[model samples]
Target: VGSRCGAAEFACRVNAAVELLDAGAPAAEAARMLADRFDCSQRQARRYVDRAAGGGRVVVAAEETVVFTVKLPAPLAIRVRERARESGGTLSALVTRALTEFLVRGQARPRLW
Candidate 1:
Protein backbone atom coordinates (compact mmCIF):
# COMPACT_ATOMS: atom_id res chain seq x y z
CA VAL A 1 0.00 0.00 0.00
CA GLY A 2 1.30 3.44 -0.92
CA SER A 3 1.27 6.00 1.83
CA ARG A 4 0.03 9.55 1.33
CA CYS A 5 2.64 11.19 -0.85
CA GLY A 6 3.25 14.71 -2.02
CA ALA A 7 3.52 15.84 -5.67
CA ALA A 8 7.23 15.21 -6.04
CA GLU A 9 7.03 11.56 -5.07
CA PHE A 10 4.18 11.03 -7.50
CA ALA A 11 6.17 12.56 -10.31
CA CYS A 12 9.17 10.40 -9.52
CA ARG A 13 7.11 7.20 -9.77
CA VAL A 14 5.60 8.33 -13.04
CA ASN A 15 9.01 9.08 -14.46
CA ALA A 16 10.34 5.73 -13.39
CA ALA A 17 7.52 3.92 -15.15
CA VAL A 18 8.00 5.95 -18.32
CA GLU A 19 11.71 5.18 -18.40
CA LEU A 20 11.10 1.46 -17.95
CA LEU A 21 8.48 1.43 -20.66
CA ASP A 22 10.60 3.40 -23.11
CA ALA A 23 13.33 0.83 -22.61
CA GLY A 24 11.00 -1.73 -24.22
CA ALA A 25 9.50 -3.23 -21.11
CA PRO A 26 6.06 -4.63 -21.84
CA ALA A 27 3.16 -3.01 -20.02
CA ALA A 28 2.58 -5.91 -17.65
CA GLU A 29 6.26 -6.40 -17.04
CA ALA A 30 6.78 -2.71 -16.46
CA ALA A 31 3.96 -2.67 -13.98
CA ARG A 32 5.35 -5.62 -12.04
CA MET A 33 8.83 -4.18 -11.97
CA LEU A 34 7.68 -0.76 -10.80
CA ALA A 35 5.33 -2.18 -8.21
CA ASP A 36 8.18 -4.24 -6.80
CA ARG A 37 10.63 -1.36 -6.93
CA PHE A 38 8.26 1.08 -5.27
CA ASP A 39 6.61 -1.37 -2.92
CA CYS A 40 3.33 -0.89 -4.73
CA SER A 41 0.91 -3.20 -6.45
CA GLN A 42 0.89 -4.33 -10.06
CA ARG A 43 -2.03 -1.99 -10.72
CA GLN A 44 0.16 1.02 -10.05
CA ALA A 45 2.64 -0.17 -12.63
CA ARG A 46 -0.22 -0.56 -15.13
CA ARG A 47 -1.18 3.06 -14.50
CA TYR A 48 2.33 4.11 -15.44
CA VAL A 49 2.25 2.18 -18.71
CA ASP A 50 -1.13 3.68 -19.53
CA ARG A 51 0.13 7.18 -18.90
CA ALA A 52 3.21 6.75 -21.10
CA ALA A 53 1.23 5.02 -23.83
CA GLY A 54 -1.27 7.86 -23.78
CA GLY A 55 1.58 10.29 -24.47
CA GLY A 56 2.26 8.43 -27.75
CA ARG A 57 5.72 7.36 -26.67
CA VAL A 58 5.28 3.77 -25.51
CA VAL A 59 3.43 0.71 -26.70
CA VAL A 60 0.71 -0.56 -24.37
CA ALA A 61 -0.01 -4.15 -23.57
CA ALA A 62 -1.50 -6.21 -26.40
CA GLU A 63 -4.73 -6.56 -24.44
CA GLU A 64 -5.07 -2.80 -24.20
CA THR A 65 -6.22 -0.48 -26.99
CA VAL A 66 -3.79 2.21 -28.13
CA VAL A 67 -4.12 4.86 -30.81
CA PHE A 68 -0.84 5.64 -32.52
CA THR A 69 -0.13 8.96 -34.16
CA VAL A 70 2.27 8.64 -37.06
CA LYS A 71 3.45 11.40 -39.35
CA LEU A 72 4.37 10.16 -42.81
CA PRO A 73 5.62 12.28 -45.66
CA ALA A 74 2.86 14.67 -46.68
CA PRO A 75 2.21 13.01 -50.03
CA LEU A 76 2.13 9.51 -48.60
CA ALA A 77 -0.07 10.54 -45.72
CA ILE A 78 -2.49 12.17 -48.14
CA ARG A 79 -2.52 9.08 -50.33
CA VAL A 80 -3.15 6.80 -47.40
CA ARG A 81 -6.01 8.93 -46.17
CA GLU A 82 -7.53 9.18 -49.62
CA ARG A 83 -7.30 5.45 -50.20
CA ALA A 84 -8.70 4.64 -46.79
CA ARG A 85 -11.71 6.87 -47.34
CA GLU A 86 -12.27 5.59 -50.86
CA SER A 87 -11.95 1.96 -49.81
CA GLY A 88 -13.87 2.36 -46.54
CA GLY A 89 -10.92 0.93 -44.65
CA THR A 90 -9.13 2.34 -41.66
CA LEU A 91 -5.70 3.99 -41.69
CA SER A 92 -4.58 1.21 -39.38
CA ALA A 93 -5.73 -1.41 -41.85
CA LEU A 94 -3.69 0.14 -44.62
CA VAL A 95 -0.58 0.38 -42.48
CA THR A 96 -1.04 -3.16 -41.29
CA ARG A 97 -1.18 -4.34 -44.87
CA ALA A 98 1.96 -2.48 -45.83
CA LEU A 99 3.89 -3.71 -42.81
CA THR A 100 2.73 -7.28 -43.28
CA GLU A 101 3.93 -7.24 -46.86
CA PHE A 102 7.22 -5.70 -45.85
CA LEU A 103 7.89 -8.29 -43.18
CA VAL A 104 6.98 -11.15 -45.50
CA ARG A 105 9.22 -9.84 -48.19
CA GLY A 106 12.09 -9.32 -45.82
CA GLN A 107 11.72 -12.75 -44.32
CA ALA A 108 11.50 -14.55 -47.65
CA ARG A 109 14.53 -16.57 -48.67
CA PRO A 110 15.86 -17.08 -52.14
CA ARG A 111 16.10 -20.60 -53.44
CA LEU A 112 19.80 -20.34 -54.17
CA TRP A 113 19.28 -17.26 -56.30
Candidate 2:
Protein backbone atom coordinates (compact mmCIF):
# COMPACT_ATOMS: atom_id res chain seq x y z
CA VAL A 1 0.00 0.00 0.00
CA GLY A 2 1.08 3.56 -0.61
CA SER A 3 1.69 5.99 2.17
CA ARG A 4 -1.32 8.05 3.18
CA CYS A 5 -1.48 11.20 1.12
CA GLY A 6 -3.93 13.96 0.29
CA ALA A 7 -6.01 13.85 -2.87
CA ALA A 8 -4.06 16.48 -4.76
CA GLU A 9 -0.74 14.82 -3.99
CA PHE A 10 -2.04 11.43 -5.07
CA ALA A 11 -3.39 12.93 -8.27
CA CYS A 12 -0.01 14.46 -9.00
CA ARG A 13 1.68 11.11 -8.52
CA VAL A 14 -0.81 9.38 -10.77
CA ASN A 15 -0.30 12.02 -13.45
CA ALA A 16 3.42 11.47 -13.29
CA ALA A 17 2.98 7.74 -13.62
CA VAL A 18 0.70 8.26 -16.62
CA GLU A 19 3.23 10.54 -18.22
CA LEU A 20 5.89 7.87 -17.87
CA LEU A 21 3.60 5.29 -19.41
CA ASP A 22 2.75 7.64 -22.26
CA ALA A 23 6.44 8.11 -22.90
CA GLY A 24 6.71 4.39 -23.77
CA ALA A 25 7.81 2.90 -20.45
CA PRO A 26 6.52 -0.59 -19.87
CA ALA A 27 4.03 -0.96 -17.02
CA ALA A 28 6.45 -2.70 -14.69
CA GLU A 29 9.21 -0.29 -15.53
CA ALA A 30 6.98 2.72 -15.09
CA ALA A 31 5.91 1.51 -11.68
CA ARG A 32 9.46 0.92 -10.63
CA MET A 33 10.48 4.31 -12.00
CA LEU A 34 7.74 6.05 -10.09
CA ALA A 35 8.55 4.14 -6.94
CA ASP A 36 12.09 5.46 -7.13
CA ARG A 37 11.00 8.97 -7.86
CA PHE A 38 8.34 9.19 -5.17
CA ASP A 39 10.00 6.98 -2.57
CA CYS A 40 6.91 4.84 -2.57
CA SER A 41 6.53 1.09 -2.76
CA GLN A 42 6.36 -0.66 -6.12
CA ARG A 43 2.82 -1.69 -5.24
CA GLN A 44 1.86 1.92 -4.70
CA ALA A 45 3.38 2.92 -8.03
CA ARG A 46 1.40 0.18 -9.74
CA ARG A 47 -1.75 1.47 -8.09
CA TYR A 48 -1.08 4.92 -9.47
CA VAL A 49 -0.54 3.46 -12.93
CA ASP A 50 -3.76 1.47 -12.71
CA ARG A 51 -5.71 4.55 -11.65
CA ALA A 52 -4.24 6.63 -14.44
CA ALA A 53 -5.10 3.87 -16.91
CA GLY A 54 -8.77 4.02 -15.80
CA GLY A 55 -8.75 0.87 -13.69
CA GLY A 56 -9.06 2.50 -10.29
CA ARG A 57 -12.05 2.00 -8.00
CA VAL A 58 -12.22 5.67 -7.09
CA VAL A 59 -12.67 8.05 -9.99
CA VAL A 60 -11.22 11.47 -9.47
CA ALA A 61 -13.19 13.68 -11.80
CA ALA A 62 -10.95 16.69 -11.48
CA GLU A 63 -7.87 14.69 -12.36
CA GLU A 64 -9.55 12.88 -15.23
CA THR A 65 -11.18 15.84 -16.92
CA VAL A 66 -9.07 17.99 -19.21
CA VAL A 67 -10.16 21.41 -20.39
CA PHE A 68 -9.57 22.33 -24.00
CA THR A 69 -10.37 25.39 -26.02
CA VAL A 70 -11.32 24.95 -29.66
CA LYS A 71 -12.14 27.53 -32.28
CA LEU A 72 -14.98 26.66 -34.62
CA PRO A 73 -16.95 28.48 -37.30
CA ALA A 74 -19.96 30.29 -35.82
CA PRO A 75 -22.42 28.36 -37.97
CA LEU A 76 -20.93 24.99 -36.98
CA ALA A 77 -20.84 25.97 -33.33
CA ILE A 78 -24.51 27.00 -33.45
CA ARG A 79 -25.43 23.74 -35.14
CA VAL A 80 -23.61 21.71 -32.51
CA ARG A 81 -25.26 23.63 -29.71
CA GLU A 82 -28.65 23.06 -31.28
CA ARG A 83 -27.99 19.35 -31.62
CA ALA A 84 -26.95 19.16 -27.98
CA ARG A 85 -30.19 20.82 -26.93
CA GLU A 86 -32.20 18.37 -29.02
CA SER A 87 -30.38 15.46 -27.38
CA GLY A 88 -30.79 16.92 -23.85
CA GLY A 89 -27.04 16.97 -23.38
CA THR A 90 -24.68 19.72 -22.34
CA LEU A 91 -22.34 21.26 -24.92
CA SER A 92 -19.35 19.64 -23.23
CA ALA A 93 -21.03 16.24 -23.25
CA LEU A 94 -21.98 16.61 -26.91
CA VAL A 95 -18.47 17.57 -27.91
CA THR A 96 -16.91 14.79 -25.85
CA ARG A 97 -19.22 12.16 -27.32
CA ALA A 98 -18.53 13.37 -30.85
CA LEU A 99 -14.80 13.38 -30.32
CA THR A 100 -14.89 9.91 -28.74
CA GLU A 101 -16.86 8.50 -31.65
CA PHE A 102 -14.64 10.16 -34.20
CA LEU A 103 -11.49 8.84 -32.57
CA VAL A 104 -12.82 5.29 -32.26
CA ARG A 105 -13.96 5.24 -35.87
CA GLY A 106 -10.72 6.77 -37.03
CA GLN A 107 -8.79 3.98 -35.33
CA ALA A 108 -10.85 1.35 -37.14
CA ARG A 109 -10.57 3.01 -40.56
CA PRO A 110 -7.32 4.21 -42.00
CA ARG A 111 -7.17 7.31 -44.16
CA LEU A 112 -6.76 6.41 -47.83
CA TRP A 113 -6.48 9.93 -49.15
> By TM-score, who's the top model here?
2
Kindly provide the TM-score of model 2 when superposed on the true structure, using C-alpha atoms: 0.47
Can you write out model 1's per-residue Cα lDDT over 14-93, one digit (the tens) per residue?
A: 67877887899888988898889888778876886676665433322234335778778999989988997776545766
Per-candidate TM equals: 0.45, 0.47
Candidate 2 segments exceeding 4 Å error: 55-113
Model 1 lowest lDDT segment of ten: 56-65
Q: How many collisions per candidate?
A: 0, 0
Model 1 scores a TM of 0.45
lDDT of 1: 0.71
Worst 10 residues of 2 by lDDT: 55-64
lDDT per prediction?
0.71, 0.79
